[model samples]
Target chain A: MSEILERIWEYRQISRVELVELTGLTSGTITNLTHDLIQLGILRENEAISGNVGRRRVMLGFDPRFYRIIGLDIGRTSFEIIVMDLNGTILQSIEREMNGVQGPEAYFQVITPTLTTVKQEIEAAGEKILGLGVGIPGPIHYESGSLLAPPNFPGWKGYPLKQMLEQQFDLVTLIEDDARTSAMAERWYGLGKSVQNLVSITMGTGIGGGVVTNGKIVRGTNGLCGQVGHMTIVLDGKMCDCGNRGCWETVGSIPGILSRWSQGSTLMELQTAIRQGEPEALRCIDETLAYLEAALVNVQNLYDPELILLGGRLFPLLAEHLDQLKPRLQSRLYAFAKDRLRIEPATFGTSQSAVGAAALMLGFLLSEPVRLLSLQDS
Target chain B: MSEILERIWEYRQISRVELVELTGLTSGTITNLTHDLIQLGILRENEAISGNVGRRRVMLGFDPRFYRIIGLDIGRTSFEIIVMDLNGTILQSIEREMNGVQGPEAYFQVITPTLTTVKQEIEAAGEKILGLGVGIPGPIHYESGSLLAPPNFPGWKGYPLKQMLEQQFDLVTLIEDDARTSAMAERWYGLGKSVQNLVSITMGTGIGGGVVTNGKIVRGTNGLCGQVGHMTIVLDGKMCDCGNRGCWETVGSIPGILSRWSQGSTLMELQTAIRQGEPEALRCIDETLAYLEAALVNVQNLYDPELILLGGRLFPLLAEHLDQLKPRLQSRLYAFAKDRLRIEPATFGTSQSAVGAAALMLGFLLSEPVRLLSLQDS
Candidate 1:
């Protein structure tokens, strides 16, 4: 019963016969499990079929009123929170702007009040929080339960986020890099659901990535696995926050885009011109694509993942240069070898980071017994 | 008794009292298993009292005469074959060279006489050849039972190596990449036994790595997972045999080392001077270390394995660089990660590849139930 519910949690709906086939169980067992799930009010049967078969098959799916997970996206000047059902269906959410957070005391003042306010809003809407998952833009120490280094948000390193949330809310708490969390969101509810080994390339103000290998996010020895943003792309490109020169981010990040366009116009000015279809704005987007092609080619030649998802606020510009990157990658691949490559746009858009955090909690707490057993050992 | 034999395989021997402490089985059960193993001629009791707590003790170990496995390392120019017992003690071995092998069929023709001669030598020396394992320089397709693009063996791609060997000898046969086989040998009989997620970097005319993750060799979808040799190190640098440019092999290979040396002096002249500790030879070695440092650092950064083993023929010239590589790697890794980093020399040297292949075959055909289990889908 739990396995079928979990599978539905992954997707919208699946038929009883399909469930039996997937689990390789007897029809009687499937009937019993589905009966128990429906009785618990966690699921309902949809009496609709879009195809011709032996009979009109009913699809079993989540009821949406069973439970909810609170996803928090902590940021420097803004915060976004979403209330999502166990089925990953977001019901009500809010985004707020923050002036500043100086230290732990300031963080406590901001977080406690915001969380209390959100909880009251949810209670008013007749929903309860199952757990809390937060996505911060930085490297987080999973073991010590502290923030390590967040380049975008200063004065936030090594904070006791897990404890702070645990004290205020009686729920499971998790804090991770925003990129990894967003990648998780894509894996569970987006294009990466079928991909086992994938690289979620998040390009925004500060570029980064989340690496998933063997069906789990690879946490580096220092929680730094997907710091490919810091990996040197050009020998002497530009200065980066990691005290390195020629980092990929220096060439592919939003700041990099602005830097390339700074010769004639800034992003603020380019956006105005791009809206009018100016040649200078078009040239800036094109050159950024060329630089991205070189960096992406290196990643492609190394990991060879099944999919590469483009997300964040900046992906709309990707279509401008994707046509050029494809042929460059194909030209470099082995001859006679079939390359199973795919590139997709993130469906969640800017809200991906928050949803990803929610998915992480769901995946961690609601995984099947077999997967839960292995997660503990790993 | 099987537990006792496994312990002996690790620490050579343990008294009956120690066996009880290790296995945690009842004294009566231990007595029965030990007696059964002795009757089966797989174990022998040594009448000695070397390792005892208070009372006299009898040590138990493998009966070396029980069986043997024949291992062959077939390189581009030479071949080294050995007959070693299950205890990993070599009985008789032979090394020979063959300059040319036109193709797989012609390659077999050149090695046939040597194979027949070695078979007779094993039986005459009273060592039964229980199985045969061969390590070649190539990508082996385990599912297809063929050699996939063997780097050094030209015209041998997609050849059914395991099937051909099995048809000839009527014994269990296994074939693996030389580097990966060496990694297996290291993981089983050398430095990587107690370690998980260790990599064996084979440095020679080319640089390749075998990644052992979560206690298994991660053979990517097409049996081409650890192509570290082809990892792009320099963008738009030298071309590699795999039809790619700027590969790590282009800069870190033996020919690269010699060419880097030849800029100032001939490689032979530098080798003679290195014997005399000349400054020019030392400088060339330093340059070679720099190239190696880039490759090893990137690999360590990516996987964060417990240890990195440097093997292959060129390691003798490259061993001194470990001191330089360790600090660079450590500075980039986590502080709490104890025993998670180290650089070790391959104790088995060139013979490890062949021994590893034998271990591979033994791992599949041995009495261990899980290894010997038929892979038929249930």
Candidate 2:
């Protein structure tokens, strides 16, 4: 039954026969499952006329308006909140500058009202919000949904973000690392829709990565699996704030790129400088691209992901320069075999984090429809 | 049914009540499955008297003599072959020196007669040989079971090893990269048995790795996952033969350690020097260890495996120095959390490769018991 729903959710408008072909389920089982789902209001069928003769075939799709999910992307510089329907279509999205947001108390102060506002607005239409999913920076204690001491987020250690949000919102809350959420979101709705095994590298103020294998997120033994940014790239080259020297993020992140020119310069300024073809800016970008290329190659060798996604703030800037970057990455690959990497910029931009956060709920809902039913019952 | 068999295999000996608790299957289902398996000679129930010895409880176990698998480990300097029962108990084991063996033809010359001799000895016992699992050192086209060009093994590129073995032996053949097989062996029958999520590193003539996630081997999109040796450790430090600069294998492998002192010196000679506290030898080992420490840390950050198994020849040599090496690795880890790494030497020693190869067949058999039924039918 969950398989049929997943097929419907993935296809958006799949027929019973299509589900049968896709799932290898007997037509009788499809008929029964779809009937039950339709009756439950989770799925709906519509008649579509084909050709001038108007031959109608029934198509199944998720009842988007029946359920909604809230996605919150909490970043160091800014935060984004989005309400998405079951189909992952954003019904409402708002981004706010969070430069001055200090501690968990300050974060709660800002987010509480925003949550109330979004919930009220959605409730006004009599739509149901099943859950909230949040993307937080740093290592997450996934089992407990607590934020670890993210280097950038100074005061957010051991904070039970999920528990706090769940108590306030009276709904199921799922929290994950921002990079992993981004990867999940991409896998479901963005550039990585078709690929099952892939790595999503978010290169921004700091580098973070997420991996998806066998169509599921590769959460490690401690939810610290995708911390590729901290991997040593240059031995004893530069001391990183994470108490390591020559970390990948130190040389490959947006700040890492900016550090090559002026440490204090904003990414916008760096982008403008590169756009003007400033030699210093170009050299900095090239050097950073080299590090990025090397890291991607390392990721490829380690995971052999089908695709490597470049995400976060720096990717839009690097998009134009990707042609220059691709050859440098390919040149470093293992010589015996033909390279099978498909490197691409993420389909979504800055708002990707928010969408991905929302995808956490959607991923759960898609994967565990029985749990969704229990939640609906509760 | 397969789940029950896997749990039984994993536990070695388990009671029916334990299987019920572990599998969460209904007692009736467990009873039915176990009865079927026992009737098919896949499982055996032995009466064991405990406590007062009046009551006898039937404990389930694999009928070791019911099935047999052959394991072949083809390496650069030597090769090993072993025939083992389903319990991974070696019935017959042989190791051969291949100082001048060149190409697949030469490999066949050495292996063919040995295989025939082993087969006759096993068949004389009136047992069935299920399949052959061969582990060759190189990148492999896992689907075709063909060995790719390995730097150590010349003239082995695109060799149809699995086909050749299958046609010659008249048995099913499974071939995998040596490192991956070693990992599989460790996971099933060695130190890694308890942990599902782990990475096995083979650091000998060349470095290679295998990852097990969610209790299954992580074969990448092209089965090129765990080629950690090829990943660049140094940025433009030393040009590698694989057309890359400063690969992990180039700087951290056995040859890499030797090259730091005198390239011609054998590991045996280096061991002697290190024991005598020779400064040059100590420095070489220390330098190579530092590089190794960085790479392992990188692996941990990337894969977040529960344990990292150090295999191949050099690890046993490095075992005594592990206490010295552990701190260096731990210091570089993420600062927020206490590092939870369990690095250990592989249990099976030099013959681990052959054992791991046999595990490849066991893994397949364990995973797909229904397939075994089809094979039996055939």
Candidate 3:
């Protein structure tokens, strides 16, 4: 039954016959499940427009207006909160900058008001609120739903973010790594819709990564599987905030790139310098590109992902130079791996992580429909 | 039904009551399934020892003597073949030196005669050969069952090894990466039996690794997920045979270690030197340990495996120094990850990959029982 709902969600509007073929479920089983879902108000049926002058078939899809999910993305420098429908369309959104907000107490002061406003907006719309989903930087203790030594946010380490959110809002809350949340967003509504094996790279002030294999996130034993930023690029070269030296982020991140480009204070400035063909900027970009090429090759060899989605603030600036990186990557990759590997820019812009956070809740709801059903009953 | 068989295989012997509790299958279903399995000669029933003051319960277990598996492990300098029963007990074994053997035709000359003898012996013993399992040295194009530009064996690239074996033996053939095969062997009858998330690293003339996540092998898009050996440890530090510079194997592999040691030409000699407290050997070992420490940290950060099983010829020599390596690893790992990360030596000795190859066929047969049943029918 959940599979049926998932297929409907994926297709937007799927027919009973198509569901039967796709799921390999019996026609009778599909009809019964769809009927129950429709009766429960989770799905709705619509008549398909016919051009053949024959019987029009009915399509089944999610009743997108029925439920809403609150998504929050907490970065080192900023936070964004949003309310979204089942189709992942943002209904309301609010963004704020964090000027060195240090601890949980300071974070709550800024977060509480924004969440309250969004919650009221969602409630006033005559829609149900399913849950709260959060995307936080760094590795998380999945069992405890807490942060684990997030770089540059030492005060946030070990904070029970999920518990705090649930207690404040009295709603079910799910916390995930920000990069993984972005990958989830891609899996649902972006380039990852059809790809099962993929790695989403967040190239920003710091480099981070998320992996999806066999259609599920690769959350390792401690939920630390996607720390691609810390992968060593130059042995004993540069000290990183993570206590490791020569981490890939030390050479490929925005700050890392800006450090080498004497004329740029920001990625935008670096882009401008490169556009003007400044020798210093070109040299810096080339050095960064070489490291990026090596890291991408390592990603291919280690994860063998079918597609690598590049996101975050810095990716677009480097988008034009991707052609230069590809041939280098192809030459280094295994022969069988070279032809199938794909590198592409991500779909969403600034809202990628926030929408992905909402997707975290929506994805859970789709997989375990009974939870939503119980919430509705309550 | 496959789940029931897997549980029985894991437990070695169990009663229907335990099967019901373990598998969550109804008592009636357990009885029917076990009865059918026994009837097919896939399982056998035995009376339990009467330690209690009650009637003895009948236990069900595999009829090991009825079936057999052939395992082959191919390396750059050597190859090994073994025949085993369902219980993983080696019945016959053969080992030979490759002596710079290259290309498919040359390999067939040596492999064919040995396989023919093994096949005749199994036939004479009235044992059914289930399949032929081959464990090759490098990444394979899984879909096509061929090697893809394996380093040092350029002539063997693109060879249809699986098809060639299947045609010659008239038996089911399975091919897997050598490291992964070693992991499979562990998963079935060794330390990995109790571990769900584990990585097995083969530190030999060349380094290799295999990952098992969520209790199954992580075969990425092209069956190249666990190329831990090629992960860069130093940027432009040393040239690697795989066309990469500063790969972990360039520092941590046996040859890589020997290149830095002036007094030793072989690993055994190096081990002897280190044991004798020679300063040069100690320095070389320390250097190798630092690189290994970095590589292991990277593996932990990227894969976050619960346990890392270290195998191959060189690991045992370094086993005594693991105490020295652990503290360094602990300091660099994430706090939540530190306590849970276990580094241990592999269970099998020299025949790890060969036995692992046999277990591959056994694993496939267990998952798809119908295939074995169909073969029985034929």
lDDT of 1 by residue, A277-307 (tens): 7776777776676566655655554455677
lDDT of 3 by residue, B272-371 (tens): 9999999999999999998988888788877888999899988888898999999877877766668999998888887889999998988887899887
TM-score for predicted model 2 compared with the true structure: 0.96
In candidate 3, list every pair of residues with a backbone clash.
Answer: none
What's the DockQ of model 3?
0.68
Residue range B49-144, candidate 1, lDDT tens digits:
553565566888766786667888877767778777767777767777666646777767767677778777767876556678888876677886
lDDT of each residue in A1-378, candidate 3, tens digit only: 778888988799888999999999999999998898887767889998756786798999887767788899998778999888777788888889987787878988999988887787777877778888899997888888888888877589889998888778888789999999998988877888899989999988888888898888888888888889888787766878776777888889988888887775988888888999999999998899889888887888788899999989888888989988888778777665688998988887787898889989888877898876686545
iRMSD of prediction 1 = 3.4
Error of 1 at A234 (Å): 3.1
Count the clashes in each prediction: 1, 0, 0
Lowest-sum lDDT 10-residue window in model 1 chain A: A369-378
* lDDT score of residue B181 within candidate 2: 92
In terms of docking quality, how is candidate 2 classified? medium
Per-residue alpha-carbon lDDT of candidate 2 for residues B1-378, written as tens digits (9 for 90 to 100): 789889998888889999999999999999999998888777898887766857878899998867789999999889999989878899888999998889989988989999988988787888888888889886887778887667777889889998898789877788988989989988898877788799999989889999999889988887778888878789877877665678899988887888888634788889888899888988988888878888887888888898998978888678878999888777777664436778988778888889999999888888988786567546
Candidate order, lDDT descending: 3, 2, 1
Please tell me which model should have the higher DockQ, number 1 or number 2: 2
TM-score of chain B of 3: 0.95
Give DockQ for candidates 1 onward, in order.
0.25, 0.69, 0.68
